[model samples]
Target: MDEAIIVDAEFVAPVGTTAGEFVPIDRAPAAGLLLLVAFVVLYAKVISKLGKPAIQEFLWEIITRIVPSKQLRRRKEAQLRAIEVHTQRSNTSSQDQFAKWAKLDREYGKLKVEIEDINNSLTASKARFFTIISSAIFLSTTGMKMFLRIKHRKAAIFWLPKNAFPYPIEYILSFSSAPLGSVSVSAWLMICDAAMDLIVTIFVALVVGVIGMLRSNKVKPKTA
Candidate 1:
């Protein structure tokens, strides 16, 4: 029992380290781990977003399939009644039929406008949600990359370009007992990189918004 316990103790290494004495796995800091997780989750989310149309279509099919027979019959009957009424109106005197059709056309135009407004509102809501998610993802990646630079004295996954005129960014320190300390030149570079990322994200979002506005204007329905 003692020998078994001793052997098990040898295998149990510190958290984030190699299990055995001979085997060495570099212990990644919490910041690095966070960055890795953030990248993975974000990548998966983007993929899911790309596939949303297909998923929605599949769900719609299932809903249609599972609709109650009585409800389906009622819908079919309503469609037939609408067709009958339209046919009756069409068979009336030519002038009367034309007047009726004009009224119906105006009503249809109004309904279409209402539907378009609803769709635009829904799209705006979705855009806001996407913006929030994207901002959170970007901030996490940038902040963690900077934290790793300060903690590990290593080159982060992303870094900023050297300044035209070099400045002393090293020697900055944190008085608080934080996991990320030892601020140096590299840390400042990481901070600069994060700022650049924020600017780029905002610019890209603005460009996208402009493109969306142009597209909507181009495709807007002409009023009769």
Candidate 2:
């Protein structure tokens, strides 16, 4: 039993190492994790902001699906009538109130076909933003874990860039840490890389999307 316990413990991921380090599947510092999560959330917010209208349109599309699929105006009217009947039935029992509320909700849902249709697209875009950001977070975490292993000289999954400047980022694998005066050359390199990533993603998306959009617009007629 004790041997089994020992083997089980070996596989368990520790929250922090003996000297106070958090590793997601490997011992990484909390600060790195914080930055990764922040980036994920912020990225999601950015995507959501950009796709808000599309998401709204999708949601509104769904309403038409549920309410007017066959254009069942009679079913909707029947629910409205049910609401009227239930409303007068009694407040004596909780079930009666719930039944009334359910009918009213269903009726309202039926009436909000256009709104739901618009909202369906919005909901989809909203969900997609979260999914992409979540993926980014997953990849960042995996990369960080590999980086930690490199820092500790434990293992290497891939070769670090020959030109890549190294920082004693491993030294900051503790809570009692702060940025020091006169940023390291390696830190500057990291900063430049991050800036380049942001600028490039934006520029490429804009240049590509705009080219397609402009060409399409030219060949298209203006809608009245």
lDDT, candidate 2, equals 0.46
Residue-level lDDT tens digits of model 2 in 45-87: 4443445455444554665466554334544564566556455
Off by over 4 Å in 2: 1-202, 205-215, 222-224
Which regions in candidate 1 have their CA more than 4 angstroms from the true location?
Answer: 1-94, 151-224
Superposed on all Cα atoms, the candidates' RMSDs to the truth, in angstroms, are 13.8, 17.1
Q: What is the TM-score of each candidate against the true structure?
A: 0.31, 0.25
Q: Which candidate has the highest TM-score of all?
A: 1
Tens digit of per-residue lDDT, candidate 1, span 33-104: 445535544443443443545544454456557865444455456455556655655665647578877765
Best candidate, lDDT: 1
